[model samples]
Target: MGNQLHASAIRWLSHVPFPTTLVWLPETVGADEEALLLAAPFLGESPDGLSLCRDPLGKPYPARRGYPVPWLHISNTHDGGQRLLLAAKHENLVGVGLDVVHLPRLRSPHKDRAYLHRLAARFMEPTEYERFQCAARQDDEEALRRRVAAHFSLMEAASKALGTGLKVGAFMGHSASLPLSALGALQLEPSVQLFFDDHAQTRLATLNAQRWEAYWGSDDTYLVSAVFLFDNEQINKLPLDEQTPFMSY
Candidate 1:
């Protein structure tokens, strides 16, 4: 149903020992029935007992599963023909959030001028700008550009996971300063592990964050990043791709 890396990623994620199912969906046309598709993978033979419910704000919660899943939270996002679905069991984890964009969507006339500088100033910390400055000085201008895109994408996805979306919650630039190397790594691999900067974890109290990265599928023209809360307080438990779940699938 998916590429080897994607299928492997889901299996790796599902083994987080948190009683969650990470399902991958194929790109489809028009509006997709996201809620239905979230449970479609695990429905197996007995699809009758699985139920999907919504809260006051129309947030989805998986009430029961025909299999053993008791409580589930799903975050669905579709952009530029790419679809990402994230689910976490409510009892083991608080919630899940996701954000993704077509990298080309960032294409704008305001490449790097007063307007772009103004927006960057509003969102990024002064220290963050220093990192960007260092990158810009390099001969690899493409890496510098991709770093900006990857870092901003991480900010957006992290905010969504905090249940704040963009307007009020998209201000990570003020408090968070991710490693430039990590940001660069994301442009090539989606499995990189990223821990929050010192300010974010202790000073800002903004989000309990870790391990958000980018992906470029064989047929995909877009980049992707996702963020999620952990079951326990071990935020930096292990390198994301190497963290073996304490519980079995």
Candidate 2:
């Protein structure tokens, strides 16, 4: 079941409208081990030359021989050390973030109907919760559960893409707030765009400006969400000077 779900996630992720690659690694694996895994013939031959590193904000990026690989962007998420969800894109993409959660795990063993709603409160704003309530009222118990799962994955995915992992200020800040308010309105259909607010645009102006979009899907077991920070004008082009021959999903 776990292998099937993992394959399903990779297959679903391949359809994302960007040049991206994804792989799964053990959650507790170190950078050297991760580099070696990625260095398999499918990716490249330079095992010793590949590794991972973090920036000042702790965003991981692909590196080579201890030096940052300028053309690779990477982001990762996991569900409590069960497995690592690693996503990579070329420098042509500003950023890429991914998150996955197990849906069955969300159901409280005690059968608490309001479990999802209550859990959302920890991260959702008041207005967001209000909108969720309005939409959730029309959903059956199962649908309501999926919506709540999507809620968690989408928000966390977007936060990771922004290089801030669920920080309070990333969702609602004085200078630049993500368009988190837009998420509340989503029906969690198949995929949707989560626009950034004016503050975000102004702040990201230097990266030739960007727009955020999230794509999500689920199986009976796992829900996966991916966030991309891409150029608004070109969508898949970045200002990097070099490129890497990384494999894609």
Candidate 3:
């Protein structure tokens, strides 16, 4: 609706270390379908990139481009269904991957453990599970959220970078052990580091995966995740302004 509302959303994602902003289009002001259409523009194409195809099921297939580096796409909707979509890019080949989830949609507490287990089992080792179980027993919601978000966000970012969807199922095959502190720690593939930050009621994580860094942000209301790609020289040349949080979206 107004700049104030947009500013609030950007503040929610202040943990990201990039110059990020959200754009609201007239058509997407209150429609989910229109919001999805806006995603096409960020892909460097028109809204109707792909023709709707039928596998005999009348299913619609929209043509989408694979992100070559780290980048993030995020959408925020209000009670009336109005939405705002954001596309953020990093200067390096290392880009960002982002995801947002409405907290109310998460399963009930009794079922949350099971859900977390199933998702974690797909990517975590036995010891990691044990630690997560302990955290759950202690009712450590923050710790649990960080663990889950870190695991899945990294998986998604890796998938985007490789131009392969979750079809590879690497997330289900690999294992990760994440710590419970705000600075959650995970021993990932060589040269990779994972950092967790909680702010404004959100949990944000950063993964230095290969030559890129992937970040995940979530809160009681939504989850925002992203991936950033960068090379050694570019990383060193990153403008200082990119790190300064802006007051506008």
Candidate 4:
């Protein structure tokens, strides 16, 4: 977790712009091959297959094992034994975060309303709790649960991208008395949209929807939420498949 950075990640930085991109792979006990395949599309020409190294912060960066990249910001989450790998690189950008959750499981006994309600009370503001109740009241219980789960996932990503993951922020000021680390504690006032200049930059994207079918290959039962923090002039939202050469900054 010391700030000393790796070199390969730095190689991606140059005077020209490099779009911020992300990839997700199921977790593996050994090396994660699925992530490597996705990376091939982005690395262009003879990539040594996407080696990774972790910094003192335990952040993974695509680089030779020991040298950490200074520009790449990474965050990941685990769901049902599956691992998600998210990496974002921008010229002097702040941070990036990613989260994934399975949708169909909302109907599972484990995620009953009582559990969700308790979790909401611990981390949500009163308004947030009320909103959840309203959402949960819908006859389409599964869809409602999915929406709530997606919202929570996005907030988690945003919290990580902000480098506060669950802490008091200047935006929250005094109203958020406790560190907003838990889902219920988040004061998602004016809204999560305000954090981004555009909609796609941060999204509660549908996983089993047609819009993303091309990107993911087919409809799957899940939702992905990501938060990207960058200076507009410094980077553009990366498309699903893109390749940029490394150059000097």
Q: In TM-score terms, which candidate is top?
A: 2
Q: Is candidate 2 or 4 superior in TM-score?
A: 2
| Model 4: per-residue Cα lDDT over 164-190, one tens digit each | 444445665232222543333122223
My TM-score estimates for the predictions, one after another, are 0.56, 0.73, 0.49, 0.56
Using lDDT, give the best candidate's number. 2
Error of 3 at 132 (Å): 4.5
The lDDT per prediction is: 0.45, 0.59, 0.41, 0.46
**Alpha-carbon RMSD of each model:** 8.1, 5.8, 10.2, 12.1
Report how far off residue 124 is in candidate 1 (Å): 2.2
**TM-score of model 3 (CA atoms):** 0.49
The TM-score of predicted model 4 comes to 0.56
Give the worst 10-residue stretch by lDDT in candidate 4. Answer: 209-218
Mark the 10 consecutive residues where model 2 has the least summed lDDT: 240-249
Question: What's the alpha carbon RMSD for model 2?
Answer: 5.8
Better of 3 and 4 by lDDT: 4
Report the poorest 10 consecutive residues by lDDT, candidate 3.
51-60
Off by over 4 Å in 1: 3-40, 43-54, 64-69, 108-119, 135-139, 168-220, 234-249
lDDT of 2 at 174: 30
